[model samples]
Target chain A: MVTETQQRLDETHAAAAPVIEVRELVKVYKGGTRAVDGVSFTVAEGEFFGFLGPNGAGKTTTIRILATLLRPTSGSAKVSGIDVLAHPGEVRREVGFAMQTVAVDPLATGRENLELIGRLRRVPASELQGRIDELLVLMKLTESQKKVVGTYSGGMKRRLDLATALLHRPKVLFLDEPTEGLDPQSRNALWEELESVNRSGTTMFLTTHYMEEADRLCKRIAIVDEGKIVVEGTPAELKRTVGNDVVELQLEADSPNELERQRSGIGRMLEGFEPVAEIKSSPAGVQLYVSDAAAAIPELVRRLDGDGIRIGALTMHQPSLDDVFMRYTGKTIREEQANVHFTGWY
Target chain B: MIGVAYETFLLGRRAFLRWARVPGNWISTLFFPLIQLVLFSQLFKDIIQLPGFKESSYLAYLAPGQIVFAVFLGVSWVGINLLMDYHNGYLDKLRVTPINRISILFGEMVPLFVTCAMMAAVILVTSLALGASLVTGIPGALGILALSGLFGIAWAGTSFVPALITKNEQAAGSLSLLFFPLAFMSTAFVPVERMPGWLQVVNNWNPISYVIEAQRALMSTGFDAGLIGKALLAMAILFIVTQAATIWAFRRLTA
Candidate 1:
């Protein structure tokens, strides 16, 4: 429940200092596959930033480089003001990474998995138990903490993996598709958890192919494709670039010619209206692209009244992030399957 | 250096727990060695009376070989554990930690010492339970476990090198089988005199034979310092060579 003023203050604070900065980072694999090509961005402290893209669009590769898991072929990245190449160990200490694949040990119990990572991250022995207990409860996994992770459900494994990453309370968290394969319910639950984590002042850098995830979680997002960021802005700002809210009118027409006549009649009536940007015909009735559909709906109804064009249903909706993606990339994202690439030392 | 040791201890404990929690790991490792120890001892009971046999029974001579065999079996697929981590992105998880990278490798290696020794102990206890004598008794049994543990640590490089080089689970697994001839050609199944002329010549240089001979002395012939020294030297040489190659492979994979 962030108030408008509080969010504005937080944004102001974030803009005052940058926690992560990348300058033309590039990663070219052995066979000349340029995974990340000249990507550059800076994340303000406390900002929730995301790279929204289809898979193989370099989101994972860029996040991996920032997390100090992979080396770049050219350019530079810094986390918490530490150069990733020059001082990766220092960068590692300040950040936590939850990979796309769940990395928990199936044989180890949930508690053991957290304990191992906590110890490796140098969480003090005195505080480790308390932290694990807190996280287990937070993740709603207290009852199953002693059970081996192999017995946990997929959502439970994901929660446990996230718990391990949060163990050390890193300053910056890098999540690569944190909820990629989750059911809708689990995905929503994890989204709430992530929002709470970001609200606690941890700078978040996330990469995902889910448009809804980016719209819901990221304060700012970069739409990436073909190893380049095609567009970057807040979700609302990006969506606004796609132009105008849509108001579709379902009409009561007995014949196709009557429907066409009614459609042209509505179009001719709304043509001179200041708020309506454009009017187009549809199979059922007419569609209006309006600057503010809610404000323009009354005027629209008045114009259509007594024209023998009866309206059965009216629906108004804002342009969605997918529309924004399609506006830039010229293809819908829903049909694209994730192209998962293994950049291991093969 | 101290940081590496600490990290290794912590991660090694996890690796050991991962092995111990799974019943299949120990069951599979001990199955072949136990079958050979029980069946072969009875099947070739009269082979001991041929010419060069000194033990009172074939089981006595067969116990030490089974102990070494258990060590071999315990380490054969140890590298696949690391490869699993690599495939599952657990390796990347560990890499992002602030600890030294070598700790990950050492962590996997250190636990083999305990598991190999424990597996060897099971065979030793079973052999004694079946009426095989331990001349030097409990102290001898402890010595045998120590040797097995050390030998297990040294021999694990065979599995690790292929795993890291190929980065393929099947290749790593099959390549470990290529070392089975080393185990079979050693003195595990026969004394040097009972072997063919060419095999006996091969036995003189076989590191597994040195370890088996030392364990055999502890089991029946009493403590032989010369035999123990030769076994230690052999393990040291093998450890240096295999581990060198293993380190190189690990570096290349991780680099």
Candidate 2:
């Protein structure tokens, strides 16, 4: 009783099969800090997967585990189906990682850096120079190819580092905040480069706290907090899960009296509305997670007018990645970034 | 392993390119030793008088010692670069590359070895300008330089232990005090025979003395196979300690 629907389902499942699978991964530092605790996810083949987490949320620990740099305290991971623990060397061969840190030799030129990586990857001697040339151009490092890395700007060094990782052309590439501190131009260029890389048939696993970048680049994302996958799905899927719309009302003033009054005033307005799934307020503003933002906004404004409570302004928009993170983790990405991250470490 | 070796060579090229891009670094590496030689030779010649039998040999003794000092000072700077790479996000990049992780450590060592060799050559040249020829013939003299390069390797190798202890450059540089005393306690400046009994015993065990004595043996008497053997053996022992220390440090931290 074979059916066409069943065949289609099988083909879809095959398309979504993960190239990277990490299950129950745990990493406990010496001081009893469980950096990565029981996190699990699968990065599907050809998917641009994002690991979105704040600093100290275990993104680096998880990345380190997959890269075979730091062994997990428990659990197992497979990269390109190779067991990370049992076959680190094999795992290394199939995965290219551009770590958060820059490790390029300052004494060497960009060309030399690429050539060295080419040779290390055992690219045939005849093909080495061509690979170097291609990577140099791709990174926009051709102008500085013969110049030492010490003289290169931060963006240039980062591009060169990325170029070295790309030189080997592995099945999957791990980029940890690939454009964290770059200028807007450089960051956009790197994003464009990554798009082309994905188009070339290599899966990219990225970790970043930049919500917009994740929304722009990743087909799927795992929002991580406290060393766990709080939720995972496409940027659109996760945003959709936050219901349909976000309702915001700015507080007219910074006074405590105004803040408390505004909080309870908005609270009363949406109390009995079922489609208004959630009402959350903070110092900056009040937000309503609603099923239909446009329909509720006129009604909401009427209540404020009837009560004689001032509405600074009200606007409704689709749920953003930040709202999704807040819905799942009870804190915004900026809060998490501020807590453990160096203000300039990006 | 061959792949690892090639990566190390390639990475060394990168480090070299960094220096070439900044020509000031090359000038400093070439000239730093000569400045130290002239400064220290004049300072010691005036200040602390050691019982070295004759003032005539003071400059001779200072010459070999400066070469050792210059090599160590120049080579140990490699650790700072390694630590900088870590801080600047470069070391982390290398960690995940398909290139052997050992290449990261070995790559640092190669440029270090080259830098030490060059500084030694500079000091040797300056010694020649001061009318100092190895009382040992030219062939014997080159051997001295070769052995001194090993001392530099051992010194630079030993630095990895501190690197593993702390990723902070300031902390690593501060800890270099331990290595400085080992050089001073050696007979690099004066023969152990002139020391008091207890100090002489300590001097005998100091590894740098073996290196200095090995060079002194060659400079004082050319092509003595037995002395060269003992010196080489001693240098080998220190080299082993350093190499082992570096490998163990890297394995312990990285694993």
Candidate 3:
């Protein structure tokens, strides 16, 4: 039955139209900056689309535009086939947005807030109560439903926000860094909840700066940077674009810059890989993005040892989305976020 | 529209229920209006000369005026409530819901304006107990109610333009910038007739003044229909203007 359900869903998605579609989306704020500079992507009917980027990478801007909160300066987007600009109300009806912070009213009880949203969405009165009860249980807030939201823990508030967004049973759910600023435990729990939500056939369009989050949740991702989509594909496919594995060499050197220069020279010989994006010194050590770590390691070591930069530490791991991100942007996501804060909007 | 009204009614019930958790807030919603009625009626009695003047009768005439003032103050004071919604993301729940978005404002208005009107009536009845006569009858009484509500529409509308524009609670309360002066410029403490030539000209043109005068005329016997019509018309125009400004602000806010 599980297989049957999965097969039916796959076939249904194959037959059904895209839930979200954006074409040449451009958003220029009141200032002169272009946040989403002619970026575009499509989200299939039931796909969990991760819009991954560093902080300044226009992820939130795109999400806000898609959520119908902000209008694009040019270009267009449609949620569930409804043009966001032309029919924002209709788009709003089809999508549920849980913004970075769960903005639940502290004065009201969790249950009251849910009921209020239910009424706003015009949920049938009889069905509304049952749905609220179901969401309470789903979010594990049944025990605290009657308590004022102000008294809720950060995780609890976030859960309620998610519940409120889901109250109307929207076709597309947009979560903007849903677990951002959350503790590791809370984030993992929320991730599990989101996975279950996906299992229930909700098309989630999630924007996240956390690479692990994108890797864990998104079937495919668009790695956006500097207001443009640098790459788009499944996580595995994008990682293949980098290399099968990433190797980092912690070399004992008097100077970091000298070590960086040494790594670059050793990096040039391993041009056997079709796409050797770049070799950059990662925060941890001198890192190389290569096609095959096993194939390149011995040759890389001989070449580096020939240069007299003794390796203090050597570790090899499968390329993560972070490495894939570094390949495209010449920097890791966290480095980009630290180096710049995004002041523009999509 | 009926759905909107009903939903607001439901929300009002919920918000009012919050008093059970924090019962102290009810004191101001009920008692604050009465205090203004008593304080202003006594303090400004001789200074504010109505069309029909009496030292004792001043309190009676000032009840409806204060009622209108109460609604203005209440709605504007609750600007922080909307800010709290913004901060907590509670408003987003309403934003994403399939229902009419106007219900968000309507729900606020239901308890706020309706309660202001009810409190205004209680003040009016209390003034009667203290020897204030009904210079006008049931129509006039109902007119007072209408005046308080319309003033509320304007106040609620005016407050919304700035409420959501603010980022957090402190900025939201900065709404008092618009509120305090708008209250004072109208007929809350003094009859529009009592203001100096320049200020009188300003007051005559003020939308809030029209609401006060129209409401005052409805509650007093010596009232003229033409002034009442003009006052009501001014309020109607201001109502449309305020609502448009609010919706535009909302549009900007979402943007």
Best lDDT among the predictions, by candidate number: 1
Q: What share of the true interface contacts does each candidate keep?
A: 0.95, 0.79, 0.71
Model 1, TM vs. native: 0.88
Clashes of each: 0, 16, 6
DockQ of 2: 0.58
- Clash-forming residue pairs, model 1: none
lDDT of 2 by residue, A256-302 (tens): 78777878877887688677888887446787787777776777676
| Winner on TM-score (1 vs 3) | 1
Per-residue lDDT of B30 in model 2? 56
The 10-residue segment of model 1 chain B with minimum total lDDT is B246-255
Where does model 1 exceed 4 Å of error? A1-17, A246-316
Q: Write the per-residue lDDT of candidate 2 for residues B204-252, one digit (tens) a residue.
A: 6777776666676666545677767877787788888888988887766
Least accurate stretch of 10 residues (summed lDDT) in model 1 chain A?
A330-339
Model 3 clash pairs are A103-B88, A103-B89, A103-B90, A104-B88, A120-B99, A121-B98
Q: What class would a CAPRI assessor give candidate 3's docking? A: medium
How close is chain A of candidate 3 to the true chain A, as a TM-score? 0.87
lDDT of 1: 0.90
For model 1, residues A125-184, the per-residue Cα lDDT tens digits are 999999999989889999999998999999999999999999999899999999988999
